[model samples]
Every structure is written in C-alpha cells, then in structure tokens.
Target: MGSRRRTPYGPGNPGASLTVHPLEGCRGIRAAGEVGLATHTIWEGVLEQAVREGEDVYYLELSEVTFVDVAGAGALAAAAGRLGAGRRLVVRRPPPALRRTLEAFWPGLPAIEVTM
Candidate 1:
C-alpha cells in the first residue's frame, strides 16, 4: 500500500469535485463539472493513486462530468493503458465530449473501456 495524499480534486469543493468511493473489492471515482487542465492534473494524480492502491478492477463514474478537454481524455486513456492486461479501468456513463475525444484521438486504445 502507498500513501494517498489528498489533492484539490479530492473532497474539497462542494460545487465541482471528485470523490473516491469504494466498490465491491474495487475502487471507484466520480467526477463532476469541467475536467479541464487544472482539474485534470489533480484528477490524473488521484487516478494514478487509485490504480496503485486498487484491485484488478477500477471504476471511473463520469455521469456527472459536464466537460472533458483533450488532456482529460488523454489522462483517462493513460490510466487505462497503465492498468495493462488482466486489469480493468472501466469508465461509466461518459459524457459526449469525452466519448468523442476518445473516438477521435484514441480509437485504438483497447485498454479504455467505456460503458453506457
């Protein structure tokens, strides 16, 4: 186990925030509001820590995410790739912007699994 340092995106803001929730033997994160460069930077670090501490399966619930820039999408894809085979980084309920970004720039990244 490694240290999980709290970032700005971690349970700080009430308006736009990212929270980590524990799933059944796995870890999950929910993101809200705009996922641009600043927030994405914090989010990327949080996701990296989650992946480092989580089990084989990790979940990123993006249902409340309103917007995601290219960097944010790239961060997501990077995390997915870092997980490698036999591990899963499932993205749930991705917004249209994120979906389009992934389809356009990262069409061949099989590690990123988007659902609903």
Candidate 2:
C-alpha cells in the first residue's frame, strides 16, 4: 500500500513481460503481459527470487498483467503458501476483465486488490 511506480510495459524473457523490482525493504514485483504454461518458468523464477531474497512481503503489482492461466495462478498461490503466514504477496490493480476470472477460479485469494 505505497505509491504506484511506473515500470516497463512489454515482453520479457521468453515473450512474457514478468518484471520485478526490489524496493529496498520491500519486494515490489510487477508482472505484465501473460503468464501460463509458456511462461510458468519465468513466474516461478520471480517468486523464487523473492523468497530466496527473504522479502517480507512480495508485492505483485499485477495491474498490467493481461492474463494468468491455471498453472500461473497455481504458481502464485504456491509461492504465497511457501512464504507462510507472516509473509505476504500483494497483487494490485488488475485489469477490468480479470475480475470474473479471479472469482471463478481463485475467489478467496489473499493480498489481491482491484485498485482500478
């Protein structure tokens, strides 16, 4: 729940723009474009890096993320679970269309907010 920071919006390694930025004491991760079977490895890598770095809270600024498949969502959930109770994974400002998708598949997700 800090200020929103503008980041690069485009494709990343392997056609997925799964971007990340370490906000000093905070671990702010911004994942855009798509995340699915084609980019699950990238997604997992981002989460792993956050965990390994011992980030207290992994703020996944997912507003710009265009899509998230089952495997992608699972990867996120798995990472959050791995972090345990004290740790947090915050997702912010998702696209207008993904609401129904989030509700249908991952309804009780924690740390997810529709900021705009």
Q: CA lDDT of each candidate? A: 0.68, 0.61
TM-score of 1: 0.73
Tell how far residue 55 is off in model 2, in angstroms.
Answer: 2.7
For model 2, how does the per-residue alpha-carbon lDDT over 1-116 read when each residue is reduced to its tens digit? Answer: 12122333423334544454544555676666666555566778877776666656667777667877666666766676677556667667765445566667667766444445
Highest lDDT among the candidates is held by which one? Answer: 1
Off by over 4 Å in 1: 1-26
Q: For every model shown, what is its TM-score relative to the native structure?
A: 0.73, 0.65
User: What is the alpha-carbon lDDT of model 1 when measured against the actual structure?
Assistant: 0.68
- What does the lDDT come to for candidate 2? 0.61
User: For candidate 2, what is the TM-score?
Assistant: 0.65
Relative to the unseen true structure, what is the C-alpha lDDT of residue 101 in candidate 2, on a scale of 0 to 100? 66
